[model samples]
Target: MWSANAIKSRREALSLTLTDLAQRLDVTKSYLSYIESGKRAPTPEQAVLLGK
Candidate 1:
């Protein structure tokens, strides 16, 4: 499962907001929010995309 808390913690640790992260990853803030909320799962490819 995608750990919502872990994602939230990491984002906070990096001092990044959802929009900031999404902008860096070239994705929508709503999509990142969905991932953070456990409402969606990123595919391995998407994970790699986000990891960049």
Candidate 2:
């Protein structure tokens, strides 16, 4: 489960801005923001990709 906090902190720890992470995931920055804010969720495949 990708909790919003975990997603946010991990990105910060990696020094990655939302736009950078979103591009890596092939999603829009707005969509990534939605995920980080708990307004949306990533699919299982996306979850797996997050590990890479």
Candidate 3:
């Protein structure tokens, strides 16, 4: 499982805003925020996409 910190670090390292990454992942910014904040987890498919 990808940790919330890992996802957040990667996003920041890539200089992507929440909205930008949400669009790329085809998810809502609120959903992404939840994932980043450890309030939720990504689905398997979303994990694969995020891995890319």
Model 1: per-residue Cα lDDT over 1-52, one tens digit each: 3476777777889899999988876779999898889888776766775555
**Residue pairs in collision within model 3:** none
Least accurate 10 contiguous residues by lDDT in model 1? 43-52
The TM-score measured for candidate 1 stands at 0.74
Per-residue lDDT of 9 in model 1 = 79
Evaluated at residue 33, the lDDT of candidate 2 is: 96
Q: Give the TM-score of candidate 3.
A: 0.96
- TM-score per candidate: 0.74, 0.93, 0.96
Best by lDDT: 3
Ranking by TM-score: 3, 2, 1
lDDT of 3 by residue, 1-52 (tens): 8999999999999999999999988999999999999999999989999999
Candidate 2: where are CA atoms >4 Å away?
none
Candidate 1 colliding pairs, count: 0
In model 1, the clashing pairs are: none
Angstrom error of the Cα, residue 42, model 3: value is: 0.3
Q: Residue 47 of model 3: what lDDT? A: 96
